[model samples]
Target chain A: MTRGRGFFPIIRSWSIAAVAALAVLAGPAAVPALAKDYSHIVIATEGAYPPYNMHAPDGKLIGFEIDLGNNLCARMHITCTWIAQDWDSMIPALNAGKFDAIMDGMSVTPQRLKVIDFSIPYTQSPTTFLVLKSSPLAKMPDTGKRVSLDDDAAMKAAIAAITPALKGKTVGVQVATIQYNLLHTYLRNVVTIRTYKTTEEHDLDLASDRIDAAIASTSYFVSTLNKPGGNQFVEVGPLFTGGLLGKGTGVGIRKSDPELVAMFNQAIEAAKKDGTIRALSLKWFKTDISPPN
Target chain B: MNTSNPFVLLGFGPNGWGASLVAGAAMTLAVSIAAYLVGLVFGGLAAWARIAGPRPARRLVGLYTTVFRGIPELLVIYLVYFGGSEALTSLGHLFGRSGFIGLDGFLAGTLAVGLIAGAYQTEALRGGFLAIPRGEIEAARAVGMGRLLMLRRVIAPRALRFALPGMGNVWQQVLKESALISVTGLSELMRAVNVASDSTRLPFDFGIAGFALYLVLTSFSGGVFRNAERSLARHERAR
Candidate 1:
């Protein structure tokens, strides 16, 4: 006989109540707001993803996003405080008022837009593959080519070319990231996919031979490759952006803070216009990832 | 490549993360102490309820312990750390207050580990209470000792002595359980190792270092508890 009143109903009701309550609470908080005077702002970053953001041994936050955020914050005339949040919790933490905005190399995508708003992209670098120099994947087709995922023919060609080499291989990407989605869409069936909390984890795993290849932004891999013992790793596969990779990396702000978003957008635009972004990208990543016109 | 040497990675030099690792160890101690205090409050109440309260109150205590003990510690930490604040904020909304209410990592981790420790501590303290000699209470009552006098003079002393060994075990459990709090992003020993391993790309070095650090912490605490047990039991007759 079924348990009296049933456990399923209790769990269902509990979850339904939770969801409804959250919806009610989240509703008013997310209603887009009018412009407000900028005074101070708090920005969060995942201080674990190198080149984008990571912590120095001295416990200081340093990386491309930190530099870029500071520049933009300066231009916007806002005093900013930075906090390091884990990658998975960054969005929820932002929405929860743990911080005013997120500059953790977050990508701008329609899916994300459903929850939060974004400043116009500052870095539109394509996603690419990084594998050991000796791995079969390192020699996969079109190593130096750039393929836009938005292009139907190029997408078809790139997928067709890389599928065979990836068969039965293990690939790793950070969990809940744009790279995960890209891997899911293109390589899930062909490869055994592993997800990690941060790029550092997958990178470490890749180094320890726990994973066959890793997927992330070329900008990250570029900075990574510059590190000592990095010569052992090589970029693999055609770089991808647009479709699943997102519009590009942008500052994630609360959906309620359209004015904050507007301010960041303006600052980012000026930086792009004046080559600050390009210069920083070069210093940190040794490449210009500033959005191409 | 420069960090390939373990000493270089662990040294206090500019390139080394010695400072962070030590700071992380210190944070682990702080969080553990905070969590232990929380466990003490919850455990004391649960034990009292189980020993003296009505049937329904006892059952509620049972349910609390059962549910917390049944789930994995990692799951408990995640559920509380990630979901608790959201739930609190939602509940707050019903009262017409709005905005996200956040539980910072340290507070969230402490509450979580404390809860799990409370479940264990309840059993330990209850066992200690059960072992208290009924004759002593009777003798105290016969001597016209009031309830408070009996508790202060007889029950508490015997129960605390018996509870020492059990509470020692619970303390150790809480110390180890603090490692699970790392997932919530509290800068504890385990998370420090994770960061260093990732940054240095030498997983084993950091892994072994973390293991050693934890061993040092637990063993040092183990000695303290052992000495405490001896001191607390000094008046008890040798069996």
Candidate 2:
């Protein structure tokens, strides 16, 4: 029964496409009638995804993505509009033609790449865990050291060491993110996972004791730790990258927008070479976050 | 686009969003109701001040209505969420407490919704007050009723009757404004829809579901308000 209904819409859309195709063959004006492309490129962000894109107290979109988007647009000589769209609706909205690009610090993982195209990464960083300062898990091991999950002995040791502290503990992660995927893959058996829409929400829940720990971008985790409210929270665990976490955050574009995608890629490359990307990263993240060459 | 798997989109199974969407709708109603009540309390005070209070009180009420109505609801939510916690923390510190004093999302969201609600409600109630005949108050006074008795016996009832329709409008405003609470990271309807959309990778399905849920809540609430208006207007001639 459901199959019947689904087939009807597909058939209907196909008929509409056929008609659109015929119209395009008739004239140049009909060509536009065949496909609707927006003039102003609308960029959508969560406006709560800190350092990448977040809302200012005065209700304006601010942060790294805002700056990067503006610079990229300027370099590409395109007129674009920025809007604060809810993070969850961003991809759907992009497909729905509500926006043209998504720059909400969204990672370009294989799962996401299946649904959309992402430009060359703008910023690359590792994912880390945030636990309360007083939590025993905070002192587990490997402070300021990078440990790849592929290193069998080190990974096994680290996992074993953190397992006791993680037992029965709730770890908060943003829903549908790489961090959540990582936690689900590596820590799901040992810890309970609670999903939130934005990192900010998880941060609030972590502070409120709704969750014992959170997994997020190291840059974002650092920002939270610096905030006056997150006094008790400290970054912990070895930073994880490459596998599930994706390469880095990028401008998520429609699969069809290759021209725009190329433009962004060029701007990103230029920005990295000119020190603009690292400068902005240092401004927002207080560290050089340019993607490794 | 594929309706073939309705269960896959909204199912209660491993892939279904049915349970999540339902829970989201329930939360939307809950937050809207809480915000509306807060607004009603604030509106009552502001309307009273506008009608019967001294000059300073009248001016203060005017300022509140103007400020809230003039600003966007999104800005108000931001200020309440980001600034509200800091304000509470300082207030807590004044009493010698050191830890963070979080205004829970529900309370912060309620305040944001209420502030916007109160702005519209002030006008609703003021219209209600004006609609009350001066002769009715005088008649209560002439019958040897004290100020409190006059208010309780005559003023309150008539004003409420007059305010019912306007209050209905305010209720709808509050219901829609509650959508903004999603920004505060509250797991209300919008936030829940967000989570479902992200998790499922079928945003169109979840978004449509969310839109339908909001419509259900709004239309259902309208029915309740219509009943309230009907009961209040029983003695009066139908328009």
Best candidate (score: TM-score) = 1
Global lDDT of each model? 0.80, 0.73
Candidate 2: segments with Cα more than 4 A from true spot: A1-39, A150-154, B1-239
- TM for every model, in the order presented, reads 0.90, 0.55
lDDT of 2 at A236: 84
Per-residue lDDT, model 1, residue A289, is: 85
Worst ten in a row by lDDT for model 1 chain B: B95-104
lDDT of 2: 0.73
Candidate 1 docking DockQ? 0.19
Q: After superposition, how far is residue B93 of candidate 2 from its true place, in Å?
A: 61
- For lDDT, the strongest prediction is 1
Question: Residue B41 in model 2: shift from native, Å?
Answer: 32
Location of the lowest summed lDDT over 10 successive residues in candidate 1 chain A: A2-11
**Roughly what TM-score does model 1 have, to 2 decimal places?**
0.90
Model 2, residue B43: C-alpha shift (Å) = 30
What tens digits encode model 1's per-residue C-alpha lDDT throughout B60-169?
99999999999999898878776877776676577555555455567667778888888889998899888988888899999999999888998888898888898988
lDDT of 1 by residue, A1-293 (tens): 01112100110111233335433322211211112435766688877888888888766789999999999989988778777778898887777655578998899988898999999999988888999988878788988788988899999899999998989999999998888998898777999999988887787788878999999988888767977778999998888888878888999988877888889989999999999999999888888889985
lDDT of each residue in A6-38, candidate 2, tens digit only? 100100011223234322321111101112233
The segments of candidate 1 whose C-alpha lies over 4 angstroms from its true place after superposition are A1-38, B94-96
Clashes of each: 0, 1
